[model samples]
Target: MQVFVTGTAGFIGYHLARRLLEDGHVVTGFDGVTDYYDVSLKRSRLAALQQYPQFSAIEGRLEDAGLLSETLERAQAEIVVHLAAQAGVRYSIEQPQSYISANLVGTANLLEAVRAHKPRHLLMASTSSVYGGNTKLPFSERDAADAPISLYAATKKSNEVMAHSYAHLFDIPTTMLRFFTVYGPWGRPDMALFKFVSAILAGQPIEIFGEGKMRRDFTFVDDLIEAMIRIMPLRPELGQPLQGDSLSAVAPYRVVNLAGGHPELLMDFVAAIETALGHKAAYTIKPMQAGDPRETAADTALLRELVGDLPRTPIKAGVASFVAWYRQYYRV
Candidate 1:
């Protein structure tokens, strides 16, 4: 299958594109490679994908609707995975306009491109942050996720609704994946795990949010990728919602959580990193930052129903793999 993937320079996008190429699928990667964190890291990821003969990439912004449309037409993609966006909660608070342009307008353009092209399967990313103000122990697909504390989460939530509208109107098969705190090798620099690892390796103080009381359903990137691979072919049908599924009754669209279904404390996660690096990290506990959640736990019962088994990468092992990659990547 020929796949059109956005954000190929990103951490998840890089890994996903590589896996698709390995599986003998032709991938047309698209990324702007903005200097959101480190452009060098993005270039390195793109370089890795360039090694594959079946992989090709485009350097452009999603805000360029004409380019996106032309690229989609040229690729003639059977499947489309939209992963490019302005990510980061605190960053969203700081640069709310960036989120508006990338997450909102950019997503709107992508949806228009996909709607015009009409791929067999359209899988875009959402976030667990949408489950804001829902103090439930484990969040379920059946739960209402109307409240979003951060602009980033709000934009993602808007993406879900906007995609549903397109799915219903255009009869497109769409799946919005609500990802938990995903981390592993080739992780984003702005993520907590990467920040912690960098600080620990440099013997710098690692800032702890919520006074180290936050817990997250930290899903490993490999596990999340595997789930996506298995789900790519499982497109939803109209008026055929599964039992307890988040599938829309009106459209052939559903919102699924890609999570480990296990919540680990922030300190426990730091401990896993410490154990992996064989070094103690200096901690600076502080109040929770805006647009950040206190705790996140996924009720992946519907995910299990869809994919049979859940991703079970332990925190320690995932952290260890990331640490090894970090050491090799930075020679630290």
Candidate 2:
């Protein structure tokens, strides 16, 4: 199979591309290698992918419509996975237009390119943040996702609806994955786990926002990739949905959560890092930050139905894997 993947320089994208190459698939990866974080980390991810003969990559932003369309047509991809975007909740508050340009305009161009050259199965990344301001215990895909508190979430929500329209009109089999708080080796520096680990290693006090009371459904990167591969073959059809399904009645599209159903407390996550690195973290508690939900839990019934039972790596073990990778990568 030939797979076209975006954001190949990113953590999730790098891991997924490697897995596909290992599975003997030819993967054409695209990434802008933006300076949103350390470019060295992004370069390292690209370097790892470059080692695989079956993997090739192009450096370009999603906003570059002609480049994206040209790359997609050149790959002749059977499986198209769109993962590139400007990601950050608080950062979205500061730079809303970036989200609009990347998530909105970039995605629109991708859809148009897909419309021109239809793939067998099209999978794109959404976020669990779309269920914003919903007090539902476990956010379900069937629930209304109309109210997005942040520009980032709003853009993703728009992507879902926009994709649904394309799927309906073009008869393209599409699946939108609403990822939870994903964490693992080669994690992004802006993410909480990376910050905690980096701060602890530097003998600096880690900032605990929301007074260490926030909760998140942390999905391991490996498990998320596993789910994606499994679900790739199970493309949605324009038909009646099964129980607990988020399939659209009007389109050959559905939204699935790529996460464990359980949500862990912020402090518990901190404790896991402590257990992993064997260092007690000094904390500076702070009030809840803007553009963040107090807690996010996923209802992954649809996911389990589509992809069987998830790997559900425990927070402690996941943290240990990340810590080891961080130490080895940075020689800390």
Candidate 3:
């Protein structure tokens, strides 16, 4: 199988591409190499992928309409996984325009490319943040996600709608995965675990937003890739939706939440990092920022019924793996 994956240089994308390549699939990766975080880290990830003969990567943004179209056609991608986006909730608040250009507009460009060269399955990344302002304990696919608290969440929700339209109009079998807080080895620096680990290791005070009261469903990266691969083979049909809360009814488009199933407290997560690194964190508590949810817990029963399993990576073990990788990679 030949797969076209965007954001190949990203944490999740890198892991996903590696897994696909190891599974004997030819993968073509598209990434912009943006300076949103450490560009060197992105480069290092791409470098590792380039070692695989079956993997090819192109450095370009999703909004580059011409480049994206050409690559999609050239790769002759059978499966398209759109993961490239200007990701970060707090960053979205400061730079809303970037989110619009990448998450929203970039998604539109990818959809256009997919429309031109229809794939067997189009799996794109959405975030659990779309369940904004919803007081629901465990958010399910059937819940109404009309109210997004941030521009980032709004764009992801818009992507779901946009993809649904494409699926309905063009009969594209599409799945929008609403990922929970994904964390693991080679993770992004912006995420809580990564930031906390780095600050603690460097003997710096880690900022605790919302006074360490927030909770998140932190899914491990390997489990995330496995679930994605499993779901890729099962495409939804045009009109027939799966029974129960498994699939969408309107079109061949359904939003599935891939999560760890357990929402861990922020302080507990920080404690896990401290335990792993053998050091306590210097904490500076602060108020919660706008567009930030106090807690995120996924109702992954729909995902489990479809894929038959959810991410089961325990926080302590996951943090240890990340710390080991970070030390090795940075030679700390």
Candidate 4:
């Protein structure tokens, strides 16, 4: 399969591209390699992907409609996975324009390109953050996600609607994946696990938000990738809705939550980090930051129906894998 994946420089994107390359698929990666965290990290990911003979990349922003369309048309991709975005909850508060440019305008350009060259399936990365302000214990796809607390979540929700409109008009088979708290090896530095491990290794105090009471359905990267790969071929079709589905009535599009359905406490997650690093992390309890949810738990009923029961990696093991990767990557 010729797969076109955006955000190949990102954590999940790098992992996904590597898996596809290993599976003998010709993959064309697209990334802006933004300096959101560390340019070196992004470059290192790209360097790793460059080793594959079947892997190629384009270093450009999604806002460049001409380049994006040209690249997509040339690739003749059978499958398209949209993962690139300005992807931080707190950062969106400070840099709202960046989110607008990347998530809004950039995604618009990608949709235009897709409209020009229709693929068999178009899978996009949405977030559980779209379940914002809803006190629902386990958020289902059928639940109302009209209220998003942050600009980042709002943009993602906008992406869902935007993609839905495209699917309805163009008959594009699209699936929107609402990811929970995803963590694992080669993870983002801005995420909680990375920050905690880095701070602990540096003998610094880690900040505990929501007084360490926040719970999250943390999905390991490998598990998320597996679910994504399986769901790739199960694109939604008009009038073919499954039981407990978020499938659209009018469009060939649906939303699925990619998660383990098990919510773990924040402090328990910290304990897993401590066990993984073989050292306790000093910490200060702090109030939850604005635009941050107290907890995020996904109802993955639709996910299970699409892809058989996924193997959920234990937090301890996942943390250990990430700690080892972090130590070796940083030579800590």
Cα-based lDDT for every prediction: 0.93, 0.93, 0.91, 0.94
Evaluation by TM-score, superior candidate among 2 and 4: 4
lDDT by residue for model 1 (1-332), tens:
99999999999999999999999999999999999999999999999999999999999998999999999989999999999999998898889999999999999999999989989999999999999879987999779899999999999999999999999999999999999998999999999999999998888999998999999999999999999999999998977777788888899998899999999999999999999999998988999888788999999988888989855899999999999999999998
Q: Estimate the overall C-alpha local distance difference test score of candidate 1.
A: 0.93
Ranking by lDDT: 4, 1, 2, 3
In lDDT terms, how accurate is model 2?
0.93
Residue-level lDDT tens digits of model 4 in 39-101: 999999999999999999999999999999999999999999999999999999999999999
| Alpha-carbon RMSD to native, per candidate | 0.8, 0.8, 1.1, 0.6
lDDT of 3 at 296: 96
Candidate 2's residue-wise lDDT over 64-102, tens digit each? 989999999999999999999989899999988899999
Stretches of model 3 off by over 4 angstroms after superposition? none
For model 1, what is the error of residue 145's alpha carbon versus the real structure, in angstroms, after optimal superposition? 1.1
Clashing pairs in 4: none
Better of 1 and 4 by TM-score: 4
- Output the better candidate (2/3) by lDDT: 2
Which residue pairs show backbone clashes in model 2?
A: none
